[model samples]
Target chain A: MTLILDYEAGNLASVKRACKEVGLDAEFCADGDQLRHAERVIFPGVGAAGSAMRSLAHRGLDEALREVILRGVPVLGICLGLQVSLDHSEENDTPTLGLIPGRVRRFNLDRTDLKVPHMGWNEVVPCRPHPVLAGIDPGDEFYFVHAYYTDPKVADCVLARTEYEHSFASAVGYNSYIGTQFHPEKSGRVGLRLLANFAAWDGQC
Target chain B: MLSKRVIACLDVRDGRLAKSIKFVDTKDIGDPVEKARAYYLDGLDELVFYDITASSDRRSIMLDVVESVASQVFIPLSVGGGIRSVSDATDLRLAGAEKINVNSAAVQRPALIDECAAAIGNQNVVLSMDVRRVEPTQALPSGYEIVINGGRQPMQMDALAWALDGERRGAGELVVNSIDADGTKEGYEIALTALISSSVRIPVIASGGAGKPEHLHQVLTEGKADAALVASMVHYGEYRVSDLKEYLQRQGLKMRMSW
Candidate 1:
């Protein structure tokens, strides 16, 4: 069964509904034991990074998530979920789990035309072949709502990129862990397909 | 490039789909869930459901309808109407709404904006203003006034000022609904939309008076709106969402055409 970590900062209902729509038998679990035994874990989050990290640490989910990743369990992070997996985030000056080698930086667009939070749908262009993005088209649009994005220190970790002011890492996959800056749960059919791909993935890098 | 969005607005009254002419002459259309699913399948960008009677009835929002629609629809769903407090925002968020829009309540108590933004993220809290054009005055310098209670009462606050205040209080997006153009099928209130869109740095959705695809294109381009919200055009089957999107795409306005 797939486990959706209820870190108290995530949109648990929408993510759960999306998983159910894609025929993925997922349950919301805040327990560490469930995270360790789950076949796949979806670490979906929203809100501020500092508060989210504090909640994760409070629930001991921070270490449990790192342990799950070390065990080679397939994990997918969404929005702030992807950010907290990085080394540090400029939002609230918070330190993260460091599951992915990167720092989350705020979008410093030179142009005044671009809006902050980067709300709405934008195209996601794949950088390399990955199982998580198997059926997703090159110009497929996914829903994104974030001011900060993950900048993977290692280029190989970036599976896809999107442009909004500048090209930022929209999707990253390192080992068995994969994450997307956009909310696949709210991205309609394309997002469902991505989640379905994750459900069927074998947790291989 | 970020494509312009075409959002379908469904006004639900007591668990059924309803439409009004400038907030009067209410008429029943169809089921909310069915219409939402149809719009979703027809390749619409997003969906907004407003419980039209919730605020006037002095009760909580219809969570059952929201839950039903959210379960069936897989796109970004924003729920509005009767969201007065942070708890209401939390309830809607838990009911699977991606965003919570506050209208009259925010004007009554601006702190609700801060409170909801604190409870949920600012990105999920939307400030939906029902604006009407009026003569320019010192107090209403922009010539547009904020209306509440389904456009029955007009607040003395200027539309531009309220928009900026909403942004200051942490509203992620602003939906400018023109009461003058509402249900008229003439076109959007370009001046009002442009005024708020230009003043605020956050994305603005131009609502009211979307008769055709050209009107949407005009609002998105000339009116300087990030998105356009439609009601009568799609609700009455006058145009399909796919056809509208194709028209916008042909007009050189980038739109997501993925099925």
Candidate 2:
């Protein structure tokens, strides 16, 4: 069973609908106790960084999630949820729950050619093979709509990295904890396949 | 690298398409759902359904259409027309509208933008403005007073200022349609569109008066809008969506070609 953690964020309904479309017994888990029953958890978010972190903390989901992840259950974070795994962010001047040893920062490019919000489909080159990206190739594009990227200390944790003005960490994993910077739900077929592989991945925590 | 969006807008009145759309090999494309589904399969970027009947009582049926479209379609769907109150916007939201476009209602009650944006978050709320070019009349004091209710009522407001206020009110996007050049097929009102796009940071979509694929390109490169929203050109089988993308690619505009 896959439980999708529901915080105060956009795209919750879309994610739940995607899980159902993919034929997974997915339930919307609002609290930590409800999430404890699922075989895996999808911590997804869309919108500003600090507001999302505040909502997670306000619901006590942050502490509960920390406990849940420490229990060795598989947890996959998406978009802003993935950024929260980093150490800190320049947005809202707040620190994140450092699940991965890294700091989140904004895209430092000042080129007139590139837009501020990279609002489109962008592909990434896979660094290594994993069940999380089973059906997708290194060059397959995923939907992205943000201005920030994560800078992790250990390069081995990164599964795939995408390029803007410069390359950045697009996907990362440290043990049972995994996170993706792009929104697989928004991406078309390639994205659906990636979510399916993650849902059915053999790497048991 | 933002992908160029090809939107399919279905104007419904009495549960029928306001304008006819041509299908690839089908007989009579009367149903909005089927047309929308066909466009989605054809790799259209997005789909928008606007209820544009001057008079109609279709609260339940309209919502049913929205729900049915949302259930099958995966791309972003925007619905507009008669979105006056927060409750009306909520009805669409419950029916799975990814974005709500407001034109007349927004001008009448500018606060509605903020209210709706607050309820559903700003990214989903799009403030649509309809403006027509004035021929520089001496009697009229201001040039380009905002037109509302399909250009029936004109408000004493500037399009640029309204665009700025709309963005300030938490609108993630704007659809600036030119009433003057609409249906003329000459080209986009790039000057009018540029004014709005330059005023605010949010993505602006230029609508109305698209003659050919070059119009789309001109709007992108010249108007500097993030996107160009079209209805008649694509609806009347003037050009295919892929044709526009190919032309844009040939003209050196960055776009997602396949998928």
Pairs clashing within candidate 1: none
- Candidate 2 per-residue C-alpha lDDT over B1-259 given as tens digits, one digit per residue, 9 for 90 to 100: 4566656667776556665222111222377787777666666767778776555577667788887776666667788988988889878877867778888988888999999888776777889888876654543333555788766676767777788899999887888888777767788899888777776777878887788988889998889888777777776677777777788878987665655
Question: How much of the true contact map at the interface does candidate 1 reproduce, as a fraction?
Answer: 0.70
Q: Native-contact recovery for every candidate? A: 0.70, 0.12
Q: DockQ score of candidate 2?
A: 0.36
* Candidate 2 local lDDT, residue A50: 88
- Give the per-residue lDDT digits (tens) of candidate 2, residues A1-205: 7878788776676676666667756777778666666678888976677888888877777777777777777788898889887788877877998888888888878666565556556776688777787767755767776778888889888888888888888889887888888877767667677778777764453
**Prediction 2 TM-score vs. true:** 0.87
Estimate the Cα RMSD of every predicted model relative to the unseen true structure: 1.3, 3.9
Q: State the lDDT of candidate 1 residue by residue for A113-172, as single tens digits.
A: 899989999999999889989999888999999999999999999999999978999999
Candidate 1 Cα misplacement greater than 4 A, ranges: B54-61
